[model samples]
Target: MAKPKSGAKKTTPAGKAGAKPAAKKDNTARLDLIKNASKRVAKATTKLVKAVPEAAKVAKAAVKKAALPEKAPEEKAPKAAAAKAPEEKAPKAAAAKAPAAKKAAAPPAKTATAAAKAPAAKAAGGKASGKAGGAASAPVVPAADRPRPRATKLPPPGEPLTKREMEQLLTAGEGRGVTGEGSLKGRLVLVNDMPNLVVVGRDKRELTFLLQGPDQEVLPAYVDHKVSVSGLIRKTTNHGGVVDVRKYSAKKPEAEVVEVAPAETEPRLRYLSPGEVSMVTAAGMGAGIKGFASIRGNLEMTGEEFVLVVSNGGTRQQVSFLIEGKAASKGLRKHVGHTLQLQGVVDKTSGWGGRISAETVEPRPSEARAVSRDEMELVHIEGEVPTSVDVKLNHGLTVRLPEQPGFTWAIEPTVAKRVGLREANFEPGPNGGPATREFFFTPRNPGTFEVEFFLAKALTPGQVDRSFKINVTVKP
Candidate 1:
């Protein structure tokens, strides 16, 4: 401010000192960045180019392999030997068709029961609209036609009824017509998706009911197939001190009979991982549901019972197969793992488990079928842990183990000599199946032990035998 000094003696002029040098430095930095960026781009381009050639080579090799024809049998001696065995001839087509014809002619009628009728709808005034009003109405069982002496009182409109009450109404002395009598009017949820419906009142208790008609019929229900039951609801206690119901009719009473075709005609199925629940959900939620077939995965037998895990095309699943049989046998251990075709009723069960009932089990295409850890894990844990395991082998063969930590079948044996220590040991299983051998070695002294077995000549590197690893410790 004193004189607004025009220039400093030791400083460069403002235009020449800072501006040009700063500009030069900026240009140099920009050039360096541009050079580095070009180098990176060029490196990436070179890698991509190299990868393309390698990928092309692989593709070409695959194409060439695909073009090659399958190798013919180097030795036709087996075919010639088979031709000599007249007994080895293929099964007759007529013999096969005969059994199939018999099966087709068989009628599955378990009993003589009339078709189911849908229950009546409730009017806005809190009264039952009654059973079907259109065609297919229940044959009129007039008051005079009913067993003599009609029911004392038609059940209430908004309350749940008991099993005894229902029985009383069903037996409500002949001539006591129950049509429009409102015998079933409440929420009826089946127990475990069971055919036996457990009527629930507004209070949410089990209401036992007598499903009386000319004959007894199995009612079909999916998990949570919620619908209003509007027939006579007789509330009373049974001998078991449980609320009983007498549902005269339902709005939808035709037990949904899902008929599946025989196993041979079964469809090819895509398997899914366990986490894929949406696939199964979509199947059940279909509006016009028909029967379902188990495709994709193997039908496994555990504890003597069979089950199928249905896999969708993706990594998820939509259903599972549940077979009705005696509780799994205690000695049960192993089963085949090839995909199987099964036929049964598709049902929705309580909780996470639901699906179809398999009446038939047919083998599908696969390399080998064996029980995997994933299959064993599906077993429902109850009671004490089992000491031994039994596995089902192909061709009606069965294997048994007397103790744990001994033979892991995969690598343990191949030839008869290797089936057991020095000799083959065999025992019959419960199901009239062949016996399997196991070798036991209880070390007499406590020490580090290394056990090794020769790899079977018949086993390939990719076969299951290569993956078996067994470790055990013994103390005396």
Candidate 2:
């Protein structure tokens, strides 16, 4: 085969000789490996079986020992006797010490109990003390802390006095020099530059008292007549008594008195003729007379001077004059519309007006007549009649005539019929010293009618005397 070809080589038939030995060697190696493995397994199994039995035996012994009860050591009789002896004696010893322990705590408990009862005892003591002291034990409050008394309320201001009430107040002496919370019913008048409440006594004597206190503020408003002031009165030596006004009430005038006639010797004025006054006025000329010149006219105010409008028939002229003395301006207002007779000197003259230095100004007297019957006087009251006065057609017009010294006023029948005069009466003075007359008249129709007021002796019945003509214009 070696010589056969280098590439072709050797071949083996079925059941070749070296293949059987190689196979047998592999089988033997495999069987030896399996046997060695089997030996290892068998040895492991045997060791396991032995370990299980030993473990079981050791576990059984542990269980048996755990289940068995433990035995205590026996005690000697002398030690037990000693322990028993102490137990029997302990109660007596504790009993002996308990008193001391309680004694030590007793002071604190007593103190606590005393502290709790002390407040109650003190409260009881306080109640007893309060009862013993009565009102004295009550808390005393300071004057500043005490409740204040309520203030007294003053009465409301009074109503104004009527003309009728003013006459009655002046005549009545009810409230004169009354002191210590009293009231004075009268007309307030200014006397000697001071406020005075003028009242007439039962004897017809006029009494005047000074007005004082807070009422002074309102007293000025009611200068001539007003309310009845109530308060304390203090009498002085020289000046008169004063009233400390506290409250006031409204008053009205009542009850009339007869007016006296004017004096016969009263100065009569010389009025210039209508033609002469017109000619002088048209020429813008003045009389240039320095002596007394009596002029009749209405008084008017211009700036600080007083002017008089003199009318002669249809001719009118304005003359300026200065009032002498310290007369109040308010007193001049009453004569604004009334006719006045002026006595003055023509100091200067101008085209518009003339300046005059006035000595005296008086109310111009009107002509009067007497009536034969008991008929009322139809006095025509006009010009600056207060709007507050109620003027009705059927109602009588109450005219307050100025007080005269010695005269009786009467109405003419013819004049009364024209003015529808109904009644007439007299009232005491509003100024408290003189007497005044009130004439009541009813108008038949609204027209300008001339009525006459006659002045006669007090006892005379039918006598032709001084007649005062009044032009009455009735309004609807």
**Which regions of candidate 1 deviate over 4 angstroms?**
1-278, 281-296, 302-304, 309-320, 324-338, 348-352, 359-362, 368-476
Q: For candidate 1, write residues 385-426 as lDDT tens digits.
A: 232332221111122232112111222322222222221122
Per-prediction backbone clash count: 42, 22
- Report the Cα lDDT for residue 260, model 1: 81
Q: Per-candidate RMSD vs. true structure?
A: 59.2, 37.9
Give the least accurate 10-residue stretch of model 1, judged by summed lDDT: 111-120
Q: What is the lDDT of residue 301 in candidate 2?
A: 41
After the best TM-score superposition of candidate 2, give how far the Cα of residue 421 lies from its true spot, in angstroms. 2.0
Tell how far residue 187 is off in model 1, in angstroms.
Answer: 31
Measured against the true structure, the TM-scores of the candidates, in listed sequence, are: 0.18, 0.18
Give the winner by lDDT.
Answer: 2
lDDT of 2 at 133: 49
